[model samples]
Target: MDVPALNQTSASLTLFCLPYAGGSAAVYRDWQTRLPGWVRLKALHIPGRGVRYEMPPMHGWPELLDLLVEDVQSSVSQPFAIFGHSMGALVGIELAHAIRSRYGHAPIWFGASACKAPGSRERKLDWLSCPEEEFFDQMRVLNGMPEELLQNREFMELVLPILRADFHLCGSYELRDREPLECPMLVLGGSQDLEIARSSESLSAWARETRAPLERRELDAGHFFINTHRDTVISLVADSLARAFHSRGSGVLPSRSYA
Candidate 1:
C-alpha cells in the first residue's frame, strides 16, 4: 500500500527498523537515501504515532508484537535484518524471536542500540507514574527530547499519553525467549548515556542473547545517539548487511534455532 515509511525497491535485503519509545516510523525514513542501494528500508510504523497517529496506542507487548510480526511477515518475503533503538531495542528483540518462532527463520542480522540486555536492566519504569515535571526531566535526560517541548505544557499534554503508552510497551515487557538467537547480532550503546545504557559493560551483556557472532559498540553521545550519529549507525548496518548477505543472494533466511 501507500506506506510512506516503507521504501520497497529491488534491493538484495530489507532492514526493518523499530524506533525507541515515542519514536515512530519517521525515525528511519531518512535512512533510505544514506544507505547502500542494495538494502531496502522498511521502518515499521507503530500505530497511534506519526503516520498512524489516529490508531489507538498499544499499551503492551502482546498486541505490539502481534502487529510487528504480522507486518514483517507480510512485507518481508526475502532475507532481512532487524534493528531497534532504546525501547525499540527491546521490541525488536522480541519481534525477531516471534518472527523466528512463527515463520521458522530468524533475521540474518539483528542490531539493538542504546538498550541494556533484557532481564539485566534496572527497573526504571517507575518514571511512568512520576509527576509530569519529573517525567519531563527524566525523559529529557534519557532521550534528549527538545527541552522546550518537554517544558511546554500544551505540547507535553498532546504527546504525554503516547509517550506513556510507549513506556508501558517497554516497561511491561518480559523477554520470553532465553535461548540465544542463531542469527548474528550487533549491540550498540552510547558512552555518555547516564540513564539506560550507562556503560559498555551494560551493553556487552547482549552477548548472551545470540549463539551466532555478536558485536558491541559504544558511541560518544547520549541516549539518542543515533540521531546525532546517524552516519555511524547507517555504516554499521550496511557493513553487517554486507557481511551477512555475502554479495549476491536473495530470498535467503539465516539458519537459526527458534523456541
Candidate 2:
C-alpha cells in the first residue's frame, strides 16, 4: 500500500482526507497531530496535485470516482473514516456509495464540511466554457484561490487547467437517486460561509443521505472553517470517530499522549 506514514504507529482507524478543488493530499499533512493516536490520517492524493502534478487532473465524475475507488481499495484492510471539505465533500458522498456497493462495507463515519448537499440546489455556472478573465474574476470574488496566484500570470497558467477541471466537475454534478449511506454522518458548516449560503436547515438536508442519525455543527467562522477553527474541527472529528468505533463494536478508541 502507498499509504503514507503507515508503519509509524499502531492505529486502529484510518481517516481518509480529501481536499477541496485545486487542492491536494498535502493540505492535511498536519492533521494527524491533532487526531488521536488510534486514528491514522491518510490524505488522498488525487491526480494533478502535489507529487502527482505531472499527471492531468480528472474532469468528470465517473472517471474520477473509478480512479479513487481503485486507489482506496488497497487500503481497506482496516476500519476507516472519510472527511472532505467543499468540493471534497461532494466527492466523499459519491465515493462512500461506491465503496459500499463495491466492497460491501461503508465507512464507520463520514465528515462533510462547508459544502451543499448534492441535488439540493439548481444553481450552475458554465465554468468549463467561461473565459479566463471572467473565471478569474469569479475566483477573486469567491476568494477560494490565493491572491498571489491570481496576480501571477505564470502561476495562473499552470494552475488554471486544474482549477477549471475541478470546477467543471463541480458544476456538472447532478445527484442521481440512490440509497442512503448506512453509517453515521457528520455535516459541518460555517455560520457565515456565504460561498455555500448554508444554513442549519440546509445543512440538515444531509440527513436524507444517511440512514443513521446525522450530526450537524456550525463553526463561528467563514467559508474555510476548517482552517479558521482547526482545534474545534479536530475535536469534533476525534469525538465522532471514537463514537463510530464504539458503535461498530470495535470498543473505545485508545487514549493518546499528545506532546
Candidate 3:
C-alpha cells in the first residue's frame, strides 16, 4: 500500500483523512483553509481509486487493515488524529485499534461521519452482487455516485468496478471483539440522513467504541453534508483538536455523559 502525502510536512498534529466509498484523496484537497495552522491534513488514498487505479482494492478486513496499519505506522511520526466518512469511518476504527496495539498509542482524536455505528445489525443491501442495472439504480438513489460517471460508458466501466469492490468491503464487514480506545471521538450525522436515522439508535451509540468522551453533531444537510456544511464540520474538528492538546498536557478531558 502506498501512502500519499496530501500536504507538505508540518510540525503540527497530522489529521489523517479516509474517504467514503468511491472517494479519493482529492475529496479533501480543499480543506486547507478550514484546518487550523496547528493541524496538518493528510488524506489516505486507498487502492483502486485516483492514482492507485491500477491496484485492485481489497475486499476483506484482515488484509486491508494490515496494509493500512503498516502505512500509518511508517508514515505518521507526529501526534495524529483520524477522520473518516461513511465506509472510511469503519476503516478509522480498525486503524485506531491496530495503531494502539502496535505502538501502545492511539490517535488524539477520532471522528466518524455519516456511518452507522458498528454492531448495528441493520442489513445492508448487497450492491456488490446485485444485477448491474439494479446496482446502478441503488447508486442513483444513494446520490453518492455522480451522474456524469454513470452516463459515460467509459467512465462507468472504470469506476463501477471500484465502487462495487468498496461496497463489497462495506457489506461484508462483521464486528469483532476489540478493546475500545481511550481517545476522544466525534460523531457527525446529517439531519436528513435517512440511512443513519433508520439504521442506528443515534450517534450516541458511537460511544461504545471509545472510553473517552464522544461529541455528536447533526448537520442540516443530507448524507454528504460534509460538503454542504464544511465550515461547521471543520470548526468542530478544530475544537476537538484544541481540547485534545489541552488535555494532553493536563491529563484530563472535558467532562461529558453519553446516553
Candidate 4:
C-alpha cells in the first residue's frame, strides 16, 4: 500500500481519473488537452477493454483493486488527485484509503461523481444478468452511453460485456465501515440520473465524515455529466485544484468560478 513518490518535475499536480464501469482510459484521453499546464491528467484503464481488449474482465472488487493499484503505481509518479464516476468513484475512495495507509500521503482532492456515498442502500437492477435489449435500455435510461452507439449493433457487441462486468462489480461491492477521508472531497451528481438515488446527500455525508471541505454540484444532465458538460466540469475541477494548491502554498493560481 506504500504509495510511490509523485513526480515533482512534470507538474505541480497530477489528476488520476477512474472511468465509469465498462469505460476505458480513452474516455479521458483528451483531458490532457483541456486541463491547465500545471495539472497532468492520467486515466486508469481497467483491463478487458480498450487496449487490453483480450484480457478477461475483473469480477470482484478486491481483485480489481489489486490490479488497479499495481497499474496506477507503474503509470503514475507525481502528487496526484483522483476523479471517479459511479464505479470509478468507489475505486477512487478505496484507492485513497489504500494510498494513505501505505504511502502516508492522501490525495490533495477526491472528486466522486454519480455515485452515492458508501453504505447507502444497494439498488440492484443487475445489468449484467439482464437481457441484452433490457440491459442497453437500462444504460439509455442512465444516459451514460451515446445514442448513436445504442443503435449500433457492432458497437454494442464490443462494449456490452465490459459494461455488464462493471455493473456487476458495483452491484456486488460491500462497504467496510470505516472513517471518512481527510482529503477535500467534491461530489458531482446528474440532475436527471435515476439510476443513482440520493447521490448528492450521500456524497455530502463524506464531508461530515472527513470533516474536510465537501462541495456538491448538480449538473443539468444525466449520469454522464462529463460528456454533456465537459468544459464546465473541467473548469470546476480546475478551480478546485487551484484552491487546494493555493491553500497548500503562499501563492498559486487564483481560483475561478464554476459555469
Candidate number with greatest TM-score: 2
Backbone clashes (count) for model 1: 0
lDDT of 1 at 178: 59
lDDT by residue (232-256, candidate 3, tens digit) is 8877877776677557663333221
Clashing pairs in 4: 1-102, 6-77, 6-78, 7-77, 7-78
Instruction: By TM-score, rank the candidates, best first.
Output: 2, 1, 3, 4
- Candidate RMSDs in Å, in order, are 6.9, 4.8, 7.0, 5.6
Candidate 4's C-alpha runs over 4 A off are: 1-11, 74-78, 121-127, 146-154, 197-200, 250-259
Q: On residues 130-188, what C-alpha lDDT tens digit does candidate 4 reach at each position?
A: 88888877788787777899989998888777888888877777777666776677888
Please list the C-alpha lDDT of all candidates, in the order they appear: 0.76, 0.80, 0.77, 0.74
Ranking by lDDT: 2, 3, 1, 4
Clash pairs, candidate 2, are none
lDDT (Cα, tens digit) per residue for candidate 2, span 1-259: 1212222254487788899888888778888888866787888877787988888988888889998888789766678789999888889988888898888867889999888888674546688778888888768756677778888999988888998888888888888888988789888988777766734455778888888978898888877777778888888887777667667775344453332
Candidate 1: the clashing residue pairs are none
Flag regions of model 2 displaced more than 4 Å: 1-11, 123-125, 198-201, 253-259
Q: Put down candidate 1 lDDT per residue, 28-130, tens digits, no spaces.
A: 9789887866677899988788878998888867788887788889755577889999988888888888887788777888899988888676554654576
Better of 1 and 2 by TM-score: 2
| lDDT against true structure, model 3 | 0.77
TM-score for candidate 1, residues paired by index: 0.86
